[model samples]
Target: MLQLVDFIARNRFFLVFVLLEIFSGWLIVRSNSYWGATYFNTSNYYVAKTLAFSNSAREYTRLGEINSDLANENARLNALVATLSQKNAKDAPVGYVPDSAFNARFTYKVAKVVDNETNRTNNYITIDKGSADGIEPDMGVISATGVVGKVRFCSKNYSIVTSILHPQFMVSSKLIRSNEIGTAKWPGKDPNFVDMVDVSRYTKVYKGDSAVTSNVNAVFPPGIMVGKVKSVTVHPDQTFYNIVLELATDFRNLSYVYVVKNRQLGEQETLKQRLGDRR
Candidate 1:
């Protein structure tokens, strides 16, 4: 206690000077209009900045919820648009200028890809949908950008899809510009590219030509876009054109996809079968 008193006695003069200086500064600022205005302005700037940061943080926290709601709304609107287009097309007469049927056939049933594989020779995707969700084998699976594959198997709550990159996967696709059709197949070499065979050599073919499903087979509807022609190679001895296609869908980065359900699929197939039997 005696030592502390000695130290305080020695620093008493300096401490008093510091206190007086601080008091003088405060008095000067309070008395001067410009100083007071400057201090308040600086304080307000900091206060406003802090408030803005706080509000931004709050908004950032709610962004996920907002984004989810927007995505749902977009999907709903797209479905409505598709339904209206289909109705309009069906009502149109035989000679009417038909809107490209591709846009109408793509009905989306959004499902998350729970599991996916691209490196394997027999790559497959597992989605969080099943028979209970109206998903069945041969149902066309696609994303907003383009085609993914077809449903191969389904359980009550889950489904497996055969990717277009698979060796067994074959889709009937045609050139969008010329309507020259071919069989799209994967060579099990490149995941990004597929081979389109049986395109006639006489047809005008070029790179960057869009390829879409022919829908001749009952598996997928006509007009679902498959890919774009990346390269075309014509063998001197071969009669058909061999074209390489760049797939529209990025299989490696697949996340959400839709399983298409055709309401009139059964009836259409039944009528075709009866006609075939009679023929």
Candidate 2:
């Protein structure tokens, strides 16, 4: 108690001066409209700026939720587009009638990419969805821009995808301009590019030609973009052109993807097994 009294006594003069200064400033602002207006404007301006900054910080924290919502909406749109494309097809072929659910061949669901690998030879991706979400092995996965990969395995709430960057991964693709079909596979060299082999050298392939999933693809829907031709080269000894594709999806930046569920996939596989169409 004695030390507190002594400390106050020591700062009494300075404390009195500070209080007088504050009171004088308040009196000036209260008596003068210009000063009051200036002070209010300045204070309100700073307060508004501080509130804006705080709101922006809060928004930054919710980016994950925002992106997930966008992905879900995009997946729904994709399914709608697929359904429309089916409806535009021949409604009744000669001597054949399609079922009511024929247009519902493909359905899409959004999954956030929880983990991704792009620097390895056999790069894989993990998503925050699985068989519980209707995702299964061999199901197609894609980003908004293009093809991503196929589901290799699935648990109750997660799935591992064999990324297109993997050397062993291959997809049936064709040049959009020439429609020459080829097998798109990674060379284990660069993440931005893939090799499209078996495209006939005689075909008029060009740089910048889009490569898309072909009708022959079992996993992905036809016309879904895979990439664009980065380069096309051929040697005298080679029958097929050495074509390079600049991948559409930047795997390093993947946050979300849409998994494609083909309703007839099981039936198709069963038929293939029975027919011994192993290739």
Compare the candidates by lDDT and give the number of the best one. Answer: 2
RMSD of each: 5.9, 3.5
Write model 1 residue lDDT over 1-279, tens digit each, in one string: 999999989999998999999999899889999998998999999999999999999999998677556545655665666556545654357776645553454455777789999888899999999989888788888776677889999999999999988999999897878878899999998889999999999889978999987746556655667889999899899899889999998888876787876655677779989999999
Shift in Å, residue 31, candidate 2: 3.0
Worst 10 residues of 2 by lDDT: 89-98
Q: Candidate 2 on 1-279: residue-level lDDT in tens?
A: 999999999999999999999999999999999999999999999999999999999999999899888888988888887677656644346766446576678889899899999999899999999888888898999999899999999999999999999988899998988879999999999999999999988879989999988878667877788999998899999999999999999888998999998888888889989889656
Deviation from native of the Cα of residue 150 in model 2, angstroms: 1.0
- Candidate 2 local accuracy as lDDT? 0.89
